[model samples]
Target: MKIYIITVLLILLSMCSCQTDSSPLPILGRHDISETDTVYHRIPDFKFINQDSNYVTNSDLKDNIYISDFFFMSCPSICPIVKKQMLRVYDKYKDNDRVKLVSHTIDPKRDTPEKLKKYAQKLNIDDSVWMFLTGEKGEILDIADDYFVAAFEDPDAPGGFDHSGKMILTDTKRHIRAFAEGTDPEDVDQFLIDIDKLLVEYAQ
Candidate 1:
């Protein structure tokens, strides 16, 4: 009787442990940017303008994978470096119709569609896969907030806009799977690898 009781107790303990481990963790929101080995919540739905001034909504992003970053055409510092890195990414995935890039302008006042078009042309941005978008300042900020990709206006800054240098990777389901520093080469490489893993997950 004692032996049977001990075995039953052990089994029940194991089951309890399993159940405890199966519970989902609390999700962190944009204001609480997670820095640990934590999974991000699903991407929030949004609507914004594309390079062509067309309305691009979350539904349009369905069934397509995309990489996104924020920048202004006239940014004099890290923007150029980030753009250079993005050029490499653009080259790698330009031929793949399944992949696309969205570059949002932090300086909507100066990055009008015409200005953005010239900037894209100057960089030879592969529009087939890459788009330089300019829209209302508040709209861009809201979308950035949803992604937890930080951006703000700094009165002291030359362009008055400050933004995070993250390269956001999203799946076909319009979910953000991963992100990396836009100016970091190793991070960008890891981002590419993550993109492949996300593609596999989406495929499965």
Candidate 2:
């Protein structure tokens, strides 16, 4: 009887462990959350110009998981390194329709649609899966805040603007699922794992 009870307890413990391990990533930003609550925060609606001069909006990205980053065509600092890391992600999901990448330019004055198109071509980016976006400076700055990334113009900063090198992962519902330092390959690898986990979560 003791052995039977021990076996039952072991099974229960294993099930609980599995449940903990499989818990979905947290929904970031200010929210009223509880230990038992399952409500999630979502990304707000937005509109911006893509490399192809088309207006890309939040609705266009419905039912897809996307990675987002901020950059400018003229940035001479971490932008290149970050783009390299972003390319790594792009290469991984280039063929997956369910995945997309949105690169926003903080310097909209210089990164017009035409310029952005040239930049994308130089990078050999597929406009369908990867979009290099630009728009009004103020609007772009406000949107950056929503993703928890910093962006602002500074005369002393390199490229005339300063921003964080963060790659953010968002789900179809626009909930931010993960983020990684765009300069760190190890962090990005972990983020890729998280992306897979989110994909599986949504698949079910």
**Candidates' C-alpha lDDT:** 0.76, 0.90
lDDT of 1 by residue, 76-176 (tens): 76898888878877888888777888888988887887777777888877655787777778888888876678898998876678887888877765556
Worst 10 residues of 1 by lDDT: 20-29
Off by over 4 Å in 2: 1-20, 33-40
Which tens-of-lDDT digit does each residue in 63-153 have in candidate 2? Answer: 7899999998889999999999999999998998899999999998988999999999999988999999988889999989989999999
Q: TM-score for model 1? A: 0.76
Q: How many collisions between residues are there in candidate 2? A: 0
TM agreement with the true structure for every prediction: 0.76, 0.86
